[model samples]
Target: MAKQKIVRVDYRLIHGQVVAKWIKYHPVKRIIVADDELKNDEFMCDIYKLAAPGNEVDIISIAELEETLNKKDDDVMIIFKDIKNAKLALNSGVKLIELNVGAVQNGKDSYFVTSGVALSKEEFKDLQEMQEKGLDIYVQPIPENEKLSLESIKNKIK
Candidate 1:
């Protein structure tokens, strides 16, 4: 199996920070945005592709991601729009050792977890399950930021 260098859950999938910072830090040849909604929207997918100029960007649905990952031999960074989608990918047999939680927009039911990260109770439960599954999940918007663990966030919520 090809290595999945980074599996990140960022609300803004392929933004300036991702292109300028995360890409450089991870040094992956391919960037895969795994979102069901984006897959069906060609115009949006094209925009995301354009955002990452040098590297190859593939905007694929969660269903197609598993197949795409299987055929790739290069180091790939997979980005999900939310933790639920990341959990879905994991349930579908995607092997991810670590997950970076970034930029989850604030919602009515969501609580602020860390810088650029907010999660509802349900989402937090999904994250807890992922952690139990042996995935190292942390909240870090950028490489320079401190990595906040799920345990710390859980304690804060309590």
Candidate 2:
């Protein structure tokens, strides 16, 4: 099976950093935004498409991620809107060895782990679970920043 080149969670999916920086860094032909809501929103879908000028941007529901991966052999990056969807993709059998956490906004019971990342208790737990499952998960908002492991964040919060 052809695996995704990068599996990332970024609330602002297909933004400037993604189009300008990430695609250049990884050189993926296709970028799949796996979000349940965005898949049904045509306007947002078109907006995301336009954001990535040269590459193909596909807005698919998280459930469709595995099937999409199965069909594609191209270098691809899968971006999820939240950690839950990323976890769901893993649970649903999408193969991912590492997860990049980026720019998840403040939500219920959430606290800032970084200026960009805010995780609630449950979200933190889910990340811990993913890490325990042997996934090398880390938070890094951009290519220039250092990737912070679960342990690093945990120590910071303590």
Candidate 3:
């Protein structure tokens, strides 16, 4: 199986930060956006594909992640829209070693953990669960920014 280079939890699956920044800095042969809802939506998938013109982009359901990654022979950056989806991927045996928390939406009851990361009570708990399972979790909104540990911002949560 090819290496799953980077796994990230970003609310915006594929945007300027990803196409213009992350991809520019850490070039990957493939980008897999693992989202259940968007996977089946052909129209939205096309738009995301267009966003990254030259790269191989696949919007696949969480169920397909393991098999897809196993079959591919190139380095990939797997992205989940939120922590829940990332957890789902983990529960399904994706073997993710580390996770990068990016711009999650500051929804109701969510606390701003850092510049671009916000977590509600439940979301923080989910991250804690992942951390307990030996997953290294950190926050870095963009490539140029410094990575912040999950423990570093625990005080931000109410």
Candidate 4:
């Protein structure tokens, strides 16, 4: 099985920071984006593929992601666009011991945890449950940024 080096929640699945910064720190051989919507959108998938020129980029559904997690042998970085998909992957048996929160676009009822990350009450609850289940969840937009744990952001959640 592939070593799951990083599991990041970024609304912009594969972009500049991922290619120019995160990869510099993690050096992943494969980038698997686990989002049902992206899995069905060929054009968007192609864009992400172009963003990460040399690496193997795959936009797969949550189910296919589970299979990939079970069979692959490379160091992989899994990206989920939303907390729901991340929770789906976790429930599907993807053992993500640590999850990095990047940029999640603001929405109604969402509270800002950081300039880049905001979470709604429901989303915050989901993350809290994940944390309770042994996931070390934190917010770190880039390699240079200090990671802020869920506990630090708890009070900010609306």
Descending-TM-score candidate ranking = 3, 4, 1, 2
Provide the overall lDDT of each model, using Cα atoms, as 2-decimal numbers: 0.88, 0.86, 0.88, 0.88
TM-score, every prediction: 0.95, 0.94, 0.96, 0.96
Residue 22 lDDT in candidate 2: 86
Clash pairs (backbone) in predicted model 1: none
Q: How many backbone clashes does candidate 4 have?
A: 0
> Candidate 4: where is the Cα deviation over 4 Å?
none
Give the lDDT ranking, best first: 3, 4, 1, 2
- Candidate 4: 10-residue stretch with minimal lDDT: 63-72
Greater lDDT among 2 and 3 belongs to 3
Worst 10 residues of 1 by lDDT: 149-158
| Candidate 1, 1-158: lDDT as tens digits | 45788889998999999989998889888999999988999889889999999899888888888788888798889999988899999999878869999888888888887878878898899999989998899999889998988887886553
Put down candidate 2 lDDT per residue, 4-114, tens digits, no spaces: 778889999999999888888888889999999999999989999999988988889988877887786788888998999989988887778689998888876788888
Error of 1 at 55 (Å): 0.7
Q: How much is 8 displaced in model 2, in angstroms?
A: 0.8
Stretches off by above 4 angstroms in model 2 are none
